[model samples]
Target: MTDIAPASPRHQKNMYMRQNKVLKDKVESLELEVLHYKEQIDKLTLGDVPQIVKNWMNEYSLPWEIFWCFEHEKWIAELDNLFPYHMENCRCDKCES
Candidate 1:
């Protein structure tokens, strides 16, 4: 009768290595897709926002203008608390108008 031996640690290690390689390839493919999407987003919007935010805008058609307005208001309130006189005389477009 033939004795079937258990897989050695070396064999297990090789199996794990192959699995890791497959996972690495998948991760790299996903990363490339993310980069492609980022390039498309950069072409669409000529701004310096994060890629994730830009992608979210593109995917969901979110109202970024409204978000920016609220963000600016929050920033102004925080800045005003920190530097009241400076914020008051900032003379930026939002502040002026």
Candidate 2:
């Protein structure tokens, strides 16, 4: 007859600590990924951006947001040869040249 022993309190606490640390590490990794993506998005130009995205940009109220959408169609080929040249422009108040 073999007897199984339950985990000790210290062993349980160590397991719990290990799990918590893994979750925290995952969260930190995700945060770093988000920061990297934000940096890339910051470098993106309005030119060649899709009309669907441009529409949202025009609708946005923030000036910088609108500027980021400025020079719309500058990357014309990005339209995949589907969208018209005049699909959308920065119509925001701050869009004036």
Candidate 1 lDDT by residue in tens digits, 12-86: 999999999999999999999999767655643675655544564576575443223332332121123333234
Those runs of model 2 whose alpha carbons end farther than 4 Å from true positions after fitting are 1-3, 45-97
Kindly list the per-residue Cα lDDT of model 2 for residues 5-96, writing each as its tens digit. 99999999999999999999999999999997676566664235566556645664333343343344122222222223343642433444
Worst 10 residues of 2 by lDDT: 73-82
lDDT of 1 at 20: 100
Candidate 1 ranges beyond 4 A from true positions? 1-5, 47-97
RMSD of 1: 13.5
Which candidate gets the maximum TM-score versus the true structure? 2
C-alpha lDDT of residue 7 in model 2: 96
TM-scores for all candidates: the values are: 0.42, 0.44
Query: What 10-residue stretch in candidate 1 is worst by lDDT?
Result: 71-80
lDDT of 1: 0.54
Quote the lDDT for 7 in model 1. 98
